[model samples]
Target: MMTFWYIFVMAGVTYLIRMIPFSFFTKRIKSVMLRSFLYYIPYAVLAAMTIPAIFYSTGHFLTALGGTIVALVLAYFRLPLIVVALAASGSAFLLSFFV
Candidate 1:
């Protein structure tokens, strides 16, 4: 019962955190600086969350590093997201066999 209540509360809090932005920010943001900052926040947060996990994700740090480099290169070249993800995991998978 306690766990169920906690989950319900958390779900509501998460919903409001995401909902408030779309409900309120109906118009395009007028500030160039603020808009640019907002555009980059997702990427920054993604890096913050994923980078540490990348180092410890596999048996070898080098394998994960190789995969990250492959993913970054593909992303820089503007490849599709699916291709980048597949190539990254494939690179890691192949390299793991060797190491």
Candidate 2:
């Protein structure tokens, strides 16, 4: 159907948009500020993506939010990423079960 074609075209455009930046900058740039920004992009993106989820989790939002705060503190103390994730997820799960 026409909708399928539309989705395919949109997906292709999105892929190109994401790929073009990396392809264009692979060898021509070497700025320290740019590198630092790139290094933090994932964290910035993760926060942007996850913050809303914490606030919007409906029945268990508060517990999840608390867990996220604890995980953040652990991360600040240099805990491993996996441990932070597990702790946060476990907290959220336990709280959801209780509440």
Candidate 3:
């Protein structure tokens, strides 16, 4: 089936992405700027991926905004992850009734 081929191709691509860096970058990277860039790449990628999901998860923009605001405030206060997550979800759930 086409689905099987798609999965096979995706798996190969993913493997190549991980393998290529390991295969070619066997020596220690000496450039300070390159090392710093590599260090921040994951966080940059994570924010890019997570920010949109946060705003769109509630289906309604207002509700999502309400939740995101609560989450950001809680996170800024250095609250526990569980507390932040629950407060965000609770805010979104409560906002859903009004929006």
Q: Look at candidate 1 and give me any clashing residue pairs.
A: none
Best by the lDDT measure: 3
Q: Estimate the TM-score for candidate 2.
A: 0.68
Residues 11-55, candidate 3, lDDT per residue (tens digit)?
A: 999999999998998898899999999999999998998888878
List candidate 2 stretches off by more than 4 Å: 30-43
Could you give the candidate ranking by lDDT, starting with the highest? Answer: 3, 1, 2
Question: lDDT tens string, model 2, 1-99?
Answer: 999999999999999999999688658448999889989999999889887777666456678787878788988999999999888778877787777
The TM-score values for the models, in the order shown, are: 0.77, 0.68, 0.75
Candidate 1: tens digits of C-alpha lDDT, residues 1-99: 999999999999999999999799899889999999999999999999997898778768989999999999999999999999999989999999888
lDDT measured at residue 97 in model 2 versus the true structure, 0 to 100: 70
**lDDT of model number 1:** 0.92
Rank the candidate models, highest TM-score first.
1, 3, 2
Clashes of 3: 0
Candidate topping TM-score: 1
| Candidates' C-alpha lDDT | 0.92, 0.82, 0.94
